[model samples]
Target: MKILSLPSSIGLASKIAKNIGCGVADYKLTRFPDNEIYTKIDTPLDGEDVVVIGNTNTDSDIMSYLFLLDAAKEQNPKRLIALMPYFGYARQHRVYNRG
Candidate 1:
């Protein structure tokens, strides 16, 4: 029963995963010389349960979530759980102030 914990930032999510005795996998990401971003996951994820941890404090984090979701799907994991400590813009629940 192995868990693949992937995080966007090491400061928040990784710290929690570490405390819980879970192994962290690095999803290699960097900005190129031309200011273009690149990312790659070099972990063995065959038939493993993958949990993606990320924050939605910024728009880029949402994009990163999409990327991680797609990667998890491609890896064909047994199960995928998305843990978002900070979820994005769900603050627009009001409709025309119809209270």
Candidate 2:
């Protein structure tokens, strides 16, 4: 099993990795001048279990998480798990003024 820690969840992911005795996968994330996200997984994940840790605090963070998820899916890991510590939109669960 491997943990892919996003910038926002590094500390938590590191703690989890320590307790689980697993290593963190190497990855890079960057933004293009056009405000697009690019993600690259440096570690090989063929037939490996992977856990992605991220917190959705802002629009950029959400986009990064989505990009990460898509990239991880392309790698064809044996299993993929998403750990979202903080979901910023959880409070919008209800639509009170629906007609």
Tell me the deviation in Å of residue 43 in model 2.
0.5
lDDT of 2 by residue, 1-99 (tens): 989978999999999999999999999998899979999999888898999999999988989999998898899999999999998788877897886
Model 1's lDDT to the true fold?
Answer: 0.66
Q: Provide the lDDT at 60 for model 2.
A: 89
TM-score of 1: 0.72
lDDT by residue (1-99, candidate 1, tens digit) is 233333445566557666776667656766689855556667766687777777776676677677767776687878887877777776767586877
- Model 2 residue runs over 4 Å out of place are 95-99
Estimate the TM-score of every prediction.
0.72, 0.92
lDDT of 2: 0.91
Each prediction's number of clashing residue pairs? 0, 0
Q: What is the clash tally of candidate 2? A: 0
Where does the lowest 10-residue lDDT sum fall in candidate 1? Answer: 1-10
